[model samples]
Target: MDMFRRTFAEVNLDHVAHNFEVLKAAFPNTSFLCPMVKANAYGHGDVAIALCLQQAGARHLGVCLIEEALLLRRGGVTANILVFRGFDREGAEQLLANNLTPVVSTWDQLEALEEMAKTPVKIHLKFNTGMNRLGFSIEEAEKLFDKCWRHPKIQVEGVLTHLFNGEDADELDGDSADQLGKLLRILLVFKPLNPLNHSLNSAGILNALIVREQKNPQHILNQVQWGLRPGLMVYGFNPLKRQDILPLKPVMTLKSVASTYRMLKVGEVVSYGGTWKAKRDSVVAIVPIGYADGYHRILSNKAEVLFNGYKVPVVGTICMDFLMVDVTDAIHGCDLNDLRDKEIILFGKSDQGQFISAEELAHRAQTITWEILTSVGERVPRVYVGDWAKRLGVAN
Candidate 1:
């Protein structure tokens, strides 16, 4: 079935590939570029996005769970895939059967592997530097290193940790730098193991590298083979908030159209709870999308859309599958005689060359970049476009 509809997401793989190339070039010493395709590649459709990154020269792909890995495998993605969330005994057996790497984070996972390992399993050890959510502590990791030191079935192929605030601006010995320093101290213990050294995510890649430079100005980032896993940036949002950092392009374009228009008299209420009333004789366009599509309800009166380059305010509480945009100021530029189907720019580049950015929408929603991207509801049909293969110099 064709999923394209009046409201949909356009995922430009060309933009994705470009971002991947830029990120890979930044870390030449990187053994491989592992673009995290978890959370459905941040709601851009994981299998399609992952395939694009692979063709764009990703050395490996990262996912959150075994189910995600299996989806890619079944979708014909044969690249080296790693499941970041460690699995149970059955999940570990499936991981082995599927030949996907598991991120062994906890002692329970290690014991599960021990009980289930019929063959040698190459695992990446996860250390909880400060996130304190997943993975073993530093002392527990020391014991884990010894446990896997020469295990018959467990092969510690790499070590990694998450940088909680790697994108924050404060540079001097802050949480991000301090946490990375702690991880490095532990990573040093496994230097002799020669695993694929990797710890930087999208936010961490540029900022953490800066931290490394500041902390060790004399020498390059150690002898271990470092790699990077660009997640959000891979989908084309700069966590550092500097567009020049990699000149990333916008990948996902959430869109819909003004299905119909209505005239609201002064004092007329709109949507639920009477939260909004037209103070003036206003023209409102029914935008056929709402919180159900991951457009936060908090963005009810706070958000705006693009119409003929004019900012049209969303004036009412967003409904489950519809909302209203006040286009009184912009209606003159559109076909006023036939106001319906005037074209609504939910978020992305507009015909007028202006962009209704996700960051702006996110700000209105009281959230961040990741939430905005990942929360783009699954019902919004994802249409992957662009010539990534040609751009990557690969045969189509």
Candidate 2:
């Protein structure tokens, strides 16, 4: 089946629906659910994931760039797509034309958006809420607010900010508090305009207690703004390390099959760099996926894949098209002969109770959940399963 040339990420629409329900259950009062589908829906295939989310009651969609949003529109998704990373003049005009909302980060970009549109453009004014990566500064935010108030063609639909230190609940740094406070201050400046003021991301929503402790608990959530922009949480990964938290099913399961399996003699080296050698006679299975396909080289010798409900240790350096795993002492019920061309669970569950989780791989890679999901390369085909996939008639 040309396994080496083809790797597929099995996306469970049922999991997506479950994740959406979890988010809804957590915050039933939330007005809009902005499921971030940026980075090709975290490499789960943006169009397919968006459809699944939309079918699961997602009213708003979030993307990293203008092109991503345009891709969704081209794919027949007609939801309110929000470009999280604000765009430039041409991009802004394109967004306006397609009825997509651009999160304006600067006064010039906002002005540029204002100039291109014949009709009013809905926008979310992003403030520098400590991430300091995007968004307008406090002074710039005030100026943009004033300008939007004056401009008849620019409608400030929302005001938002991102939290940088959401992972550490106990250490809710002064910077995040200041950023939230700054956003609140900015919101007051434009209160007469009644723009949707929101300052929370996945971490903010998950760590509401931290946010509440710092600022006015009532206003930070229910009372004050329009809604929260939750991305990772909606996708079913816990951003915060809280105790006894609600379980969230991971929406994407990246998997490939074992194309070749062989036994290697002791002292024999495997893969590139000769970093790993067999201590004894070992049965090695080659999985048809690698770094180029987003299996990640960093996971070399540190990751595990599931086969026949058993966890197999990944050995040697991960290659561009394959990686070797030690399957000599696989758990009971594992049949090496039957596993050839059979599905190898790289990061998802199997019928026999084997599953590789994105969170576990992310920890091994020393990165975030977002990076792990987004890094799944384009070559890996996506198989969507569940009601959304059935309704859309998208092939597995």
Candidate 3:
């Protein structure tokens, strides 16, 4: 497939590999470093990102669906792929065929797995420790395991939970601690089984590290094989938006070119709704990207794009396929004719070493960095670059 549009997302694979190592160092006790590659690697091209991580020594990977695991398997991801979403009978059959692990949290899922397993199959038991979204309750898990009714073919490989308030350090000592305490009690039931235990996400990992430094480190983590599954941080964006956190690089740079240039007179209206009127003679650059491109419509007149290392306001209402930027001040950096072909950065690093972070862009759009990255529509081609690109046999 050929990408004809100038508007696209550039993914730096090296940054991803670097981030993987940094995250591993942060969670030193991680027996399994499972980076979530679901939602098409958060819309950053799953296959490429997965392969890069696998090469960077990721022995395990996490996804949200059976189909997502199958995609990675097809893409030559030989690592242990754990499907976070529990499976049914039909989904269980595929798991057996593909050698994929399912995170079981429901009786139906257990029944389905037991009925389908002719050979031994490994599964992770998910406990609901206040994150009511998924997983069985502590009492439910205790009763289920105590019954000793698990299929001989069904093997419990790990016990895991989600941290609902992992971003706040105080919550790590309170709510997250309560959650882990529940997970710890569950761990006792499976102690003889020796299953890996994990509960920290991106924010949880950072907050947990902070708690470890401020107090004695080896309480819940000392006795068991622990795992860390970081999603957003794997892509090099800070989930907590703290400057003191890991020094990770932004992997994807959303960019476009100034496709058309126009000189707007004072009082002249621009774009739909005419919400913005030129206060002075302004150099308007029509960037070929809009709401359909994952650039939020609400960012109509609030977002800024980088032009020649200068931040230019996105003036007027953003259209379905275009947005107008006032490049009058930016014109001082380059000639008007030169500006037409100049690369405009929506977010991430530019050729001139200037960088615009997705964190800032998401903030301006009244959203989060996760949404901003995944919201990038499939229409935008993902151009893979970095030292690992050629190693992955990928090209821009």
* Top-TM-score candidate index: 3
Better of 2 and 3 by TM-score: 3
Comparing 1 and 3 on lDDT, the stronger one: 3
Q: Backbone clash tally for model 2?
A: 1
Q: What would the TM-scores of all predictions be?
A: 0.92, 0.91, 0.95
Model 3 error, position 66 (Å): 1.5
Task: Give one digit per residue, the lDDT tens place, for model 3 in 137-211.
Answer: 898866767643365787888889988887763353577777887888988887777778888788877766655
Ten-residue region with minimum lDDT total, candidate 2: 217-226
- What does candidate 1's lDDT look like per residue over 300-382, in tens digits? 88888887568788988999999998888886755666765667878888878879889878888889888999999989988
lDDT of each: 0.80, 0.77, 0.85
Question: Which regions of candidate 1 fall more than 4 Å away from where they truly are?
Answer: 1-5, 168-172, 208-226, 241-243, 337-339, 389-396
Candidate 3 — worst ten consecutive residues by lDDT sum? 216-225
- Root-mean-square deviation (CA) per prediction: 3.0, 2.8, 1.9
Could you tell me the C-alpha RMSD of candidate 3 in Å? 1.9
Error of 2 at 86 (Å): 2.5
